[model samples]
Target chain A: MKLMRLLCWIMVFCIDVHVKAEETHKEKCDFNRGNCVILAEDGRRVFRSDEILVMLAPRALLEIRNENTVQLVKGDFYIETEQPVKLQTPYAKIWCEGECKGLFSRTAVTLEVKSLDGNWRITRAGEKTVYVVPAGLQVSIGEVAENGQAQMEFPQSLPWVPTIKQWASLYPGKVSEFKPELEKFRQVWREAVEAVSVLHQTVATRAVASHEAEVEQARRQRLAQLREDQGLRNLFRDKNP
Target chain B: MPLILYMRLTSFLCFILVMMLGWMQLYSRAREIFNGTSEIKAEIGHLKSTTAHERIAMALEREQFLEFRQNVATLMPDVLKSKGLGEEGYPYRSLASSISRSEAELVRQTIAKTLFERAKDNFRQEKFPKAIHGFHQIIDHFGFTPYVADSYFLLAESHFKQNELEACTGVIQEMVELFPHHELTGFALVRLGRIYQVQNRNEEAIEIFKTVMRSFPQRDVAAQAKASLKGIDL
Candidate 1:
């Protein structure tokens, strides 16, 4: 019996650990209007995680599947990442890696991926073959074949890529050239995150403290009840004797 | 009899232990539910606070970008001259220079477009003050962009909505002076005429209406001007 009880407890512990391990980490929208639209008509919406940053052009729709995967419903996306990430569209799944900077766009009948600064591995939705796309190249997949796979075009050199100089000029004093200012912004972001974490910790501690107090009160009541029941049993025993 | 009593006592103790365990299980379930509720409430509170913070942060970013753009715009003329490029040569330059003039123009256009859209949204939401501010920002800092024409008209409209007739007239006159050939200039003239009529200056209103009718003949602005004239029995 003791062995069985011990096995049962061990199984419970293992299951608990397995459930925690299986819990998926979801990505949250960091910046955008409530419906994932840009705040301004011409502005882009930004979503960030620890590993990747995604910018959605106006009218683009993106859904987060997990920490490293996103589903692009339609429209254009500019993605930058320091880790491998997956972009899912109706036509294909694009796996990007190693400081990836890419543009992805999808429409009802087609999908396009451009690797501006990194590498991409694309597999059609129903196909087994994967195609590699290198930096400064683009791939377009259009129309499904008889075997239910989209036909991917040969990777070709991208027609145009925005230069670093152009990007810096577009957002002057905010990016590339403005290291100190960016650092200041990052500091603010860190402080805000720390403040929120502290607030969460305080709230959790208060809740746990209140729960402990309630449990202690209930335990005391149960002990009193048990004592009274014991006294009644003793009186009954004496009477019977 | 003694052995039977011992078994009875042992069974009773077993029953007590099971009952205690069941009670503990029930208490733990209740505690879980309580903790879950508290966690959900805390999450909701955190989300609300974070959303507000995000909005403020975004607003600050926009403000910073706008200030940067204004500073860049102010320095652009001198920079162009120093590089031996005409002021009108802005969009023809390459990135070889410290500041790419074409990129600067693109940035200006983007800021102007964004400001115009935001002002339009504010106008639709009936937030005249914020709308006026945005339109003014576009006109003051991004005057070279195409949105300037629309911004001028909207600024006048915002002032009109706020019943600031004098300010409305001033903006309309400025729009007409700056963009005499612009389609919105005709509209601005007609609006100015209407403002004159509202101030009971019928003669001046008629003169403005006649100007609109003469300059914008066979257009929507002429029709609007004619309607205003007929309203005053001209």
Candidate 2:
């Protein structure tokens, strides 16, 4: 037992020493979550939690051991290092992993979709499949693909999830008298949906009517051509007599 | 004699071990130096490639500009004379055409840059209308540039500035729609919270702020957003 304890202490001491050594050479670059950026380093920047995104810069290594989800919106990025990263999420669609280096070169396009089930899959639609972001691992979707297959880049997590009562308290009048306000909102939404549907139908009807009119005009022109031909024949006969 | 020999052998072994350790350290240091040199070389190569491309592009632009200037100079006198007002009409017409074309191109580029600068200035000054106009001009005129995303964000900000809550929200919604993967996504979210705050929608503001803090804690704006969220009633 004494030997084992001593070995454990030595291990801890060695780890501390290694950490200090690493810190001596480590430099940090500032970045925002959910925003694409160029990482100005060779080594991968480690993301510490599932609630945050570590915007991977161009050619910068992204090391995510465990994260809830990673959203990729636009830009060209690569995960070229040999590090095993884990993803834990449901319904994620950003393509960011595997032996492939995802190259998204479109000006404004998406590259992947993320599921909530801890799966990060390739999603560049109608473009070369550059990277198959590894399954069950966090990914950085910075590449812009021509196709809009990239899942919406959402922040890894919401900072605070308020309870129903707490949410109600945030707004002075809206949440306090919640039921009526909700009903009113529902009524407004329904009206908006109905209005939009009606507008669409009206446009469709107009288009159909215009097409029918065009067809009718073509028929009338053909009939007029036939009548003109017959009139010329009759006039020729009278001239001959 | 045996005892002395044993002592000497022990001392020699110790020296050899120390020397081996020193040599290993030196080898590691040299390896590190080699790796750093290679990295620097790669960076320099990349920079050189980029510089070469930039130089070529600049040369092409300069050539085009010079050609246009010469054509206009040659045509101006002819047009004035042809006008029968003691001026060369043909040369002037040709000159005017060439100058007009160049001026049009210049205006397009200038308008884009001007809009970008104006938006930034208006944002700083809190002059929402001018900022919105500038951003709209960029979007309308320079949709092909990468600055279109920026214009969308700026337009959203303008709507927010005018106290058009729904309009601002709608514009931001469009921005997110158009450029879901843009670098300014986080900035747009931050602006959304600020708009909510102005309208006394403290809860919504707090929610958005919290989202920024939790999702983008590393962002510069996130730091301010986080601090603001803490002060909210929620």
Candidate 3:
């Protein structure tokens, strides 16, 4: 037990050093978490966690500090990373492991995993069997022996589990006295939609402008061709005559 | 006199013939330029012009972009009626038409950011209840998104401020569970330990602080956890 504790201490020390080193190299770029940002490295990932635990070396190595990882313990997390990394759930030691680069989330009753790039597999603990999870497919890997099939439906939506939306009837999360005040953000939501729409419009406009410039250039070239043909004909008449 | 007049007529005829020759030469030069063989080579030096279909598509996109930008600009009133603050005016202006998926994602992310900031502002202003509500909304709407984690942490803080220990505990537990390797997890653990201490659950608090020391030895949270443990021991 002493030896194990010593090893754990050494590992934590090494990870701490590694985390400090990454502070200089990684920039968050386009990455974001909630309304704030934690790490700015690589800009391709987002990390959402309350704390670090588990057998993994460190969040820094996995680029989790910069949105490269999805911590689905509290809520769902979506991130995109160029670097290849594998995922292990809290029950990863007992359940499964696989490459991840997409959306991953969990509720009290179920864990869902989806990959956008390609297919990956999650193997059962201490078993030879592996479950292949294809890209764009969502699956809830029900307990270890549940035959690793990916399911499309979320548990919150199931008849038995009620969500905040269905809480008047009964829900999964603890019942709260205060509602989310969803109605309050209505105007901001509308503005958000409008902002996105406008941004798209700008892109389309630029594309059109580029195309128009090309057309004008083509017209000039055509006119030049016609003029050159006329010139050549006159020269030929003079020579033949 | 008749001999002199005949000489004048010959000179006039010679001048007319010279003028005709000059006219012929000028016409020939103009026609060569018009033939476009040399001009074509000169004009298309580097540019490989786009196809007709491509040009048409671009024109259509440009037209749509203009229309969309105009429409979005006029979309809403600058002032929004929020829950607590009625008819609050936003300072920024609106912009629109991207055709690519990546561009669309960028726009979506930008909007999420705007909403996230608004929620954060509520927290910074000491409006704990309103902030908690706002953060919850973000998590509910944008769960599994980059905003979810931030919302979770802030929501936990909001609950902590309101002295809602149970709710705070639940939020922190969720954060730690979801993000076992995140930096905030260390902070959450520390917070959890403090809460435990407040409740006089010394042993449980010690365990949580030890977990932080074992997991994140270099974090300030670890130091705080160690201090808490020492305080408990003394």
DockQ of each: 0.00, 0.01, 0.00
In candidate 3, what are the lDDT values of residues A1-241, reduced to their tens digit?
Answer: 4544554554444342334453353343332332222322232233433322211111112222233332233234443334333444422211223333334544433456544334455543224456655443345643222122222232111121212232222211233532342232233334444554575588779989999999999999999999999999999999999
Top candidate when judged by TM-score against the true structure? 3
Q: Order the candidate numbers by TM-score, best to worst.
A: 3, 1, 2
- Model 2, span A25-84: residue lDDT tens: 344423223222222243333332323333233333322222323322222332221222
Q: What RMSD, rounded to one decimal, does every model reach?
A: 36.2, 33.8, 42.8
Write one digit per residue (lDDT tens) for candidate 1, span A1-241.
Answer: 4644554564444342335431133234543222232221245556666776776666566655455666676677777777767776656778875766667766756788866555688987447788877665668986443333456875655543242222233222344555663354345435544654575688889999999999999999999999999999999999998
- Chain B alone vs. reference chain B, TM-score for every model: 0.57, 0.46, 0.56
Relative to the true interface, what fraction of contacts does candidate 1 keep? 0.00
Q: Candidate 3: misplaced stretches above 4 Å?
A: A1-241, B1-100
lDDT (C-alpha) at residue B187 in model 2: 79
- In model 1, the Cα lDDT at residue A58 comes to 60
